[model samples]
Target chain A: MGRFHRHTDGTVHEHEHPDVRHDVGDHTGYRESGTVRVEVLENLLAENDRVAAANRLDLERAGVRCVNLMSSPGAGKTTLLRRTITALSGTLQLGVLEGDIATSLDADELASLGAPVSLVNTSAGFGGECHLDAVMVRSGLGRLALSDLDLLVVENVGNLVCPAEFDVGEDARAMVYAVTEGEEKPLKYPVMFRAADVIVVNKVDLLPHLDFRMDRFLGHLRDVNPHARVIHASARTGEGVDEWCAWLLHVHGTPTQRG
Target chain B: MCQAIVDTVTAHASGRQVRRVTVRIGHLRQVVPDSLSFAWEVLTEGTELAGSELVVEHVPAVVECAACGERTTLDWPVLVCAACGAVDVRLVSGEEFQIASMDVAEEVP
Candidate 1:
């Protein structure tokens, strides 16, 4: 159906293979030993792996545990953070980086709680910025007192999908989804919930008032990530805060609140 | 070219009310497709790219050996042939970074 070329005796030989014959010297560097060719199939993710390695090293060196918290806008992320800060303030010196498209409200809330919080206001709306990368996190980290903090929680711009894909040199990725968001959230955003090390079903205090069903919500979460631990809590009330705090301590290997 | 594609796609995305988008970036450029995908996911949410899908088509380079008449396709740049371990080879194809496709859906009215 198309024109191609190849070599033939006395006649124009149509192209048999458009694929170029590789030079044995540099292209392959393949040393053929008794008909056996061996070349390592290195993944393109090598760069990300290298950066991740460096990030892990950086986190270890700082002696600061970083938590990347993701959730929907009104999923009670700030509320949960507020609750956590209040509970952990006396024990752990916590710092935060609040990412928002164009607002300082989240940072203001944290600051009011007497926690060190920095605001990252992105103009992604103009150029179409998607997610925060390691570079952005590093810049925000530079603004914080990395030496003095026991934990640095990066509250990503609320939206479950994109925040899950980024690696901000955090010790672990956690998610806080409010019960009011609906039970089908985990099913729709399986990738995000699956990526999380732990899932917090916040605003349990509203269970009696809202039509939210816990069984279905939890079932979807388990189907998505069988290993991810779930925490039920209300940032407004003091219920389940101790269990959440205990889990944090166990994960970070400190006492009650520091972890 | 890169900015143009991004801008066009972003505009297309905003018009359709896409929350997130995935693009398959072939295995050629230094751009880690994950970074772009991650960027696409976060940057789009709450606006137009809220739930858009990004599927990066990573085209692996194919190589053919001149000495042993060996041919193979691979995802990464493997200079030596895994079959014959010959140094003499040619890259048959690769070095392409294109949107394999886009994932789009109608916005709720």
Candidate 2:
């Protein structure tokens, strides 16, 4: 049985039920259960790592920077991608792979920005899969030639949880959050934050009109990810979008051209 | 336990809980079975596969002699065997990430 416990130190731990033992054996004899813990000489993620490395190598060889964009529903992922396309279109031609449970709405939004976008619908036949895999993304890439694009942004299904686990050959994985979400998000869900390289707190133009506390949100974000850069902006008013785009160009597109 | 590792990782895993986790290590991979199991338990503490168990297997590499057709299993990456000083040896298997089947539990309709 799995039992959850909170110690006085406030650290939470789940306990494993010890296997049953036999008392029929002598001091040095054999036992029925709780056998010696076998040393597992296995790298659990061994398979995925190989595929991820290959994906990265392919991206580098093609000179295409792949970025995985993750967020919750209505966290402004497509909106952010649209703004990113418009902002970086001058120097960096962008492509988008929009993963959704259903519909082409997100893909449509991206195409309206004049960006080459592909929508991967994983509605039912995918066995209720929540996130996109490298193989799936690779197949999507096959339809587009990398020579024409500088950046390929994968707007993963609007989920803060599962997308953190799978890698889609992106040079980096970034998380998106909005002011409407509570500050406790990072604490309530840490897996996504742990995997993020950048954190975009969108819809910040509503900060003055909402109960969002910038200090609290920053503290929580820092607690989970101390190194990830956070950009506060309104995808609507394009407030800090320029700075965000500048950072992206520095990391993925063209940096030396910046003034 | 494999289940524990699966459970702890399932929350983070988007596709499926890994069914069979295989590992490959070189003598120089500096990976110890105990340490690996310890890391697995520590990492798999509180996920969807808490109750599952682990299967650990070792892959001993075979190196071929450049001068002679000698096949040796006790070969290291720096295989300057005491028998032959030939620095050219083709390896047959025995690399890391031997993880084979992920074997996610089939979803019921």
Candidate 3:
């Protein structure tokens, strides 16, 4: 018998067994058995998780806090980073691990900000991988001197899906959600929203011209992740960038117990 | 994810011919079964594990309510309790993503 749990009504709910197929095999009496069952119980993402844990340990040992920033394409992640870099200039030592599918476009933009920036391009893969996994971040760390930085912001590839699924050994996860992406985004992409520790609702400066409802969007976000710290900002207008920088300072100051 | 599975299967099989690969995937992982199967086929093609059956056992997301102490199997992605409607609920089991086992041909002496 597999694992069983009791409901509030006293009914025992037996966990579904994948081995049921063997008992319900074809009634036709035919047995060609030369195979043995090998128990290889392991998480499929163990490799990635292991690498992420190692990366976290290395970062922590070097006394650096890392944050993974994610968002959809054109959601102003780069712009927010630019604003944040400017706002936190000289206040804290910072470095950026800019991840992109191809090209050095975003890296070039951040390089001009006078901060150490390492670019990790995944264009070698088939059409380039959508997200930056732990291995990629580990490789990017090679070019960066972790001891010199107080915080490392990994600007993940512009992807809301796969980026949330992969842990890049960051102390926290922040995402940029633009108001132009529609109010139903939180409901549609619950996983990404739920994974974020901080969510920045960017492009609030365009609120007067767009038909986007902030209330509905926030309501959906609340439904998906009530605990996420949300900040309404406009990377273009330099609005709410201070609060974002404050949060970064907070993360940098706090001793992270995460691995 | 498929690539991960393939790498795991290859490492575990170790000179043996795999017949079936069984994996337990949680609903919260948001992996589509059909897409995983297709990816498995594509990834395993021309490899040692080619033609092996990939069995995906979906695990439903279940949360234990903190206030009411009721375990609710969630149909949706919302983390609220079904009985008490409380948002403070601890997830019991839904984030699982593992390779449970595999059926491999016995070694020829």
* Best candidate, TM-score: 3
Instruction: Quote the chain B TM-score of every prediction.
Output: 0.61, 0.63, 0.96
* Candidate 1 chain A minimal-lDDT segment of 10 residues: A32-41
Question: Candidate 1 lDDT (Cα, whole model)?
Answer: 0.65
In model 3, what is chain B's TM-score?
0.96
In model 3, how large is the Cα lDDT of residue B101?
81
For model 2, how does the per-residue alpha-carbon lDDT over A1-53 read when each residue is reduced to its tens digit? 64544434342333233444345546342222222221233454545556777
- Model 1 root-mean-square deviation: 16.3
Per-residue lDDT tens digits for candidate 3, residues A145-251, read: 88999999999999878898999899999999999899998887889999999999999999999999998889889887989999999999999898888888888
Error of 2 at A255 (Å): 2.1
Candidate 1 vs candidate 3, lDDT winner? 3
lDDT of 2 at A195: 76
Compared with the true structure, what per-residue lDDT tens digits does model 1 show for residues B1-109?
Answer: 2343455455444343432333434443345666776776566557555565565656676668777878877543334455786656676656454443333332221
Taking all chains together, the TM-score of candidate 1 against the true structure is: 0.60
lDDT by residue (tens digit), candidate 1, A133-210: 565666677687777878878888878766665566778888888888999887677657867988888888889999
DockQ-superior candidate, 2 or 3: 3
Query: Which regions of candidate 3 are displaced past 4 Å?
Result: A1-32, A125-127, A254-259
Residue A12, candidate 1: Cα error in Å is 30
